[model samples]
Target: MLSDKERDQVRQTIEQQIAEAEKEMVVLKELTAAVAPDNSIGRISRMDAINNKSVNDAAYRNTRTRLKRLQNVLEKVDDKDYGLCMRCGKPIAFGRILILPEKRVCVSCSK
Candidate 1:
């Protein structure tokens, strides 16, 4: 079992990461909405509409993936299993958190 202080540290780290991810997702959503064909101005053409739709689809998929990852991390936090190597059930190194805020496996177990 982890000490109280250690658990708190991990919680705080995850909280910060979650906040940043939410902020980024919000910005991405806003940007995507701005570029949506329905909201855009100027002359419209078939090719231009197709191109916009393609870009919108790509961006939406990317943002949704990121959001899902963030939500998964949050669920891990709720389960009190954050910061553990998912593969080996070992404690993940603190330094690894900086590189991968929501990593499920540590360097060794990830290999």
Candidate 2:
């Protein structure tokens, strides 16, 4: 179980990560828009742009997923089971939570 102070720290870190991911989402949206197909561009250049856009789109999706998970965790941060490993019911290390705020299982159960 985590002390109140520790939980507060985790909440603050998760909020900061959410803010950064939101900012990145905005930048990715702009990049995706800029890469839209243009007839004036050569076929090869257009193909490259399409590929870049695909990668950016995937990244944008991942960021959105991560943001959602973080927000959900933030809402549950004060719950009694918030820091417990979902699979093992053990207290997840604070360090691990700091590194992976969205983690729901411990390293042992992850195997």
Instruction: Go through the candidates in order and give the C-alpha RMSD of each one to the true structure.
Output: 4.3, 1.4
**Per-residue lDDT of model 2, residues 27-50, tens digit only:** 998878866567899899999998
Query: Which parts of model 1 have CA positions greater than 4 angstroms off?
Result: 34-63, 78-82, 98-101
lDDT scores of the candidates, listed in order:
0.66, 0.92
Per-candidate TM vs. native? 0.58, 0.92
Worst lDDT run of 10 residues, candidate 2, spans: 30-39
Model 2 local distance difference test score? 0.92
* Local accuracy of candidate 1 as per-residue lDDT tens digits, 1-111: 345676566667766766776777676565455344553455565457567766766776775676577667755654566677789988788777645756778899778
For model 2, the stretches where C-alpha displacement exceeds 4 angstroms are none
